[model samples]
Target: YDSCVNSVSDPSIFVIFEKHQVYPEYLIQYTTSSKPSVTPSILLALGSLFSSRQ
Candidate 1:
């Protein structure tokens, strides 16, 4: 059970958009996931981080 939960929570499932040039329009497509592996807070944090670089 622990292993299954850990696997599901694995943040690696999300693509590192910061590594590539991405526009706001396509951000939804990359961030959307059917598995619900990521939380909205995490996405907001990443969004701020990426925006800070620009």
Candidate 2:
């Protein structure tokens, strides 16, 4: 997959990590438990981690 990553056109998929996180599972459950579509707000909440200075 690493060799093909450069050929891929999708900007959303970059890399896959082996580390697991309960928070990510929680986010998926919360988003999919009720509705099929994942809310943008929930995505923003998850993405906020990268924006933090600390």
Candidate 3:
């Protein structure tokens, strides 16, 4: 996928975004029991790591 990011929502996702130097709007909140993840947890993680520092 061109311009698409592979997300994992397990803090590991940050590696991809950080490496690419851009943030994906969505994140998959993968959990120890969740199936096909999605929701606020992932979003918060993304924001925590990728959002503008200023």
**What are the lDDT figures for the candidates, one per model?**
0.57, 0.55, 0.61
How do the residues 1-54 of candidate 3 rate in per-residue lDDT, one tens digit apiece? 333435545443333334565666898785486567779999999898876676
Instruction: Give per-residue CA lDDT, model 1, range 1-54, as digits (tens).
Output: 112222545643433335444344544435555785889999999999999995
Off by over 4 Å in 1: 1-36
lDDT for model 3, please: 0.61
Please, what are the lDDT tens digits per residue for candidate 2 over residues 18-38?
434212434333333654788
TM-score of each: 0.33, 0.27, 0.25
In candidate 1, which residue pairs clash? none
Clashing residue pairs in candidate 3, if any?
none
TM-score of 3: 0.25
Q: Is candidate 2 or candidate 3 better by TM-score?
A: 2
* Poorest 10 consecutive residues by lDDT, candidate 3: 8-17
